[model samples]
Target: MRSSVDIETIFATMAVGLVAVASILMTSAPLGAQDGSRSRPVSLGADDRAAALESVQFALAELGDGASYVWHRGHGKLSGVVQPTQSFVDGKGRVCRHVVVLLSAGEKSRKTEAIACRLENGVWRFDS
Candidate 1:
């Protein structure tokens, strides 16, 4: 048998706990999943370019096949998906990543593949 004040306190504690749980869930959810939006055209701003470059470097270092990152293509003015398809060590002992990227603009999309090698300076350069 709880008093009115005790019941109120229990309800308040439960509410707080529920709020904390909701916040945790929201923060842990993926950005795209939370918004329920498909991949859209991304503008290649300075920050976006830096993030895309970093993602590429991370993918190369991890060397995980099918691992992907989002990028923005300036020439096509579209959003792009960059994924590592394969990786190998070259004769010069440089780690190379073969990547495939899909660039999408409006209703059109283009797919391109390239090989990028990790340099001594820790930078990944596309090998043409």
Candidate 2:
């Protein structure tokens, strides 16, 4: 037989737990689905472009409207359309690559575009 105070404590604790779980799920679930895969640009038609653009779109969503990106069409080592990656600029303005995917020779003919951004003053802004 729990008292009223005891019941209130339980409900409060449960509500906090639910909020924590929901926050984690909302943040982590969309990016990491074990089944569905996103596409990357490669040598192909419109479908291939759409597939390739999925990653770009995901990255751009909720991003600052002023963010900028450039077209990088060249040789890469990425195996899949999307690969784990990071980008940063050194003090001298040189860009750094953390992870990259090498593409396949078969997909070399695919045409694509990319948008990249930089963090400025704790907010993301477009880069040229």
> Best candidate per lDDT, number?
1
TM-score of each: 0.50, 0.25
- What tens digits encode model 2's per-residue C-alpha lDDT throughout 1-128? 11112222322343222112112212222212323545332233333333333434343433233343332323342223323245666565644222221223222322222223434433222232
Q: The CA-based lDDT of model 2 is what?
A: 0.30
Q: Give the Å shift of residue 51 in candidate 1.
A: 4.8
lDDT of 1 by residue, 46-67 (tens): 4333444565566666758877
TM-score of 1: 0.50
- Whole-model Cα lDDT of every candidate shown, in order: 0.51, 0.30
Error of 2 at 34 (Å): 36
At residue 56, give the lDDT of candidate 2: 42
